[model samples]
Target chain A: MAEEECLTELELAIQVLVFNFYKYVPRRSLVRNKISKSSLRKMLQTEFPHMLTDTGNRKAADKLIQNLDANHDGRISFDEYWTLIGGITSPIANLIRQQEQQNSD
Target chain B: MAEEECLTELELAIQVLVFNFYKYVPRRSLVRNKISKSSLRKMLQTEFPHMLTDTGNRKAADKLIQNLDANHDGRISFDEYWTLIGGITSPIANLIRQQEQQNSD
Candidate 1:
């Protein structure tokens, strides 16, 4: 069976998240699965243009990365990347939900 | 400006994830933002047909939910749901990466 044939929306979303992560990782980087801090900053600027408004703020981005980088490693692991995305997503989700409720009322 | 007009791919992906959660929630559930275990199970079976082969196994689904329900609240909150998605996505990401590497070699 072609796995992609029956993939659902959630699954596709997961793939998009993963593929985006790989897009930020340097091909020649010794650490294959991790994204460096600078790459992460650029990723936020590019991939999260609307959701993360402070991507241009170096200090804010660095502090956000530090919060996500659980091990205090300057780079972001896949888990850390997931956390970052979730952090950004949660508030947006709430805002969207509130807007939806307001519109329905 | 239409916020939807310029949302990047990553932001869209995040919305997909959040909207999928609401898809399974009952309209009149006492809890506004939490997903019941049964709803979560159905979501896994329907949305992750390929990724979660054990969706047919009730015990396994329950156990998975139990692990994700950090507060033992008997329901999956959005944070727990995000964690669950991350858990499933990580291995699949690694597998896809390996496949890509193999194809390029």
Candidate 2:
């Protein structure tokens, strides 16, 4: 009887995405990068409010915090955080999808 | 203020993984292949019990079904389905990890 103990790479992708999205919040003081924490917060609030649930805003943020605490060091690392917000990898898929949606608008 | 309208590749990866996992389930009759539906059933029941949330065991199975129905076409494609159960791409990682686990056992 063999047990499936490892996560699929897809799960790893999801974990990385979630981690990158929230890596900035608590560690705002540490990561003085090009993207600011306030900017990230605004992006999340406006772009993905569906992620928030029936219990109001706090619970959604709470789940995010738990997911990003991957090392469970009570904090999110810089690498652990950036991959969460990866919306595009290139010039084409990035620009094309947006242009298509805007044309319909 | 630009909004993020597209899912990242990472989300697509998650979608593919969950989709592949359940594609074999409902359309068992159509999928009379090398891997029988019964084997899949045993695998899910044994390998991944953590996926089940246990409302006496029905809701967990229900959630899995919904994820695999990506097109809502009422059928899962062979491509969509196989990618879901991809625990390995064969060879090294597969054999090495298994041997390590067995040695520990």
Candidate 3:
């Protein structure tokens, strides 16, 4: 019943990540599917405020965006966006595992 | 207040993906951090039932595992695990975007 009416938790989470990328992609851009560096900064600040606080600082955000822009094209493609999310998750994932271990002990 | 008390939505989503990998890793393996093909199949069946129904077919699941095992090690490392999640999300993302556009129209 619930399975038929709604997506699984993992599916919903994946959608959130994907939808966030499209949210900032400019509709009128020639490359409408990708997000520009400036738009990425704004998206990070708004959607991931707690995860990416440095987005408030233009230089810091630019540096971060540059790392995610693998093609050096000044735009974040879906693959680049996925990479950024992976980068953010890796360290936090370790921290979470540590916490879980502590609590289980 | 909420930020201090709990992880942001994106962070929680990331943790779910990470923890799912750890859940299937065998505790007594020489390589505890990575998941074997068998364990990965079990995980896909249990944690991603809707998304990975083909896991019930042993051959299909093994084929999927082979593709995700990037280093030919027969084990799924964190990077490999991330790649699998990315692969699953990409097509669903396009579908979701189409649905959203239709709703807005």
Candidate 4:
């Protein structure tokens, strides 16, 4: 609720990840607080267009949703969503480190 | 790197999370890319001071680190580190949602 400038970049980043989950969760659902597969696809296509373009298509996105939906409930819960993001970011982080090392060397 | 102004808040946040892990990982070791317990504690205290002050003390931080060291190797890999951050954020996100719902109602 405070001004955005007061928060550290890390703190703000965590907020964005959290807020993105809420932003995609469907309204008026019996499930209440989960993201439907369609919503998950839309979110990837919109919020992560550059990173997830390979999975941006409906079929690829469906596969991604399936992988993340550990419960096989056909929906993406916050935990699943977090796991998905972690999965995506881990390799990128490794690549960045590798590049930095190469540059320094 | 490109200018920060070009990135979405979400994109920047992902970078922060990724960069934080690299920031704490130890260098010049056989285990070249892992975070030792001391590094993890220092990171939590410095980077998450507001949210993790309860674990700021060495003992509590040790306990937290033990729980996160899923492999029980006494150090944190990037995966373990991501899990720790996810664990910390989940409850906070729930609380925020509850508060928002109450306010809206």
Query: Evaluated with TM-score, which candidate comes out highest?
Result: 1
Cα lDDT listed for each candidate = 0.72, 0.39, 0.63, 0.69
- Candidate 2 residue spans exceeding 4 A from truth: A1-61, A64-72, A75-105, B1-5, B27-38, B41-105
Q: Write the per-residue lDDT of candidate 3 for residues A1-79, one digit (tens) a residue.
A: 1254355666556656876778777766523467888777676666666555522334444565677665677777777
Query: Mind giving the per-residue lDDT tens digits that candidate 1 earns over B1-105?
Result: 126767777777888998998777665652477788778878877888777662233445456677866567777777778987787677667776776677767
- Model 3 clash tally? 0
Give per-model TM-scores: 0.83, 0.25, 0.73, 0.81
Model 2: per-residue lDDT, tens digit, B1-105? 123345544434434443444343443343322234444556456543432322133353445545665445554443333432322121222233344456646
Highest lDDT, which number? Answer: 1
lDDT of 4 by residue, B16-65 (tens): 89888887765554136678877887787677655554223445445657
Q: Candidate 1 vs candidate 2: which has greater DockQ?
A: 1
Residue A59 in candidate 1, Cα distance off native in Å: 9.4
Ranking by TM-score: 1, 4, 3, 2
On a 0 to 1 TM-score scale, where does candidate 1 land against the true structure? 0.83
Predicted complex 4: DockQ: 0.41
Q: What share of the true interface contacts does each candidate keep?
A: 0.61, 0.08, 0.19, 0.39
Error of 2 at B48 (Å): 16
List candidate 1 segments past 4 Å from native: A54-63, B54-63
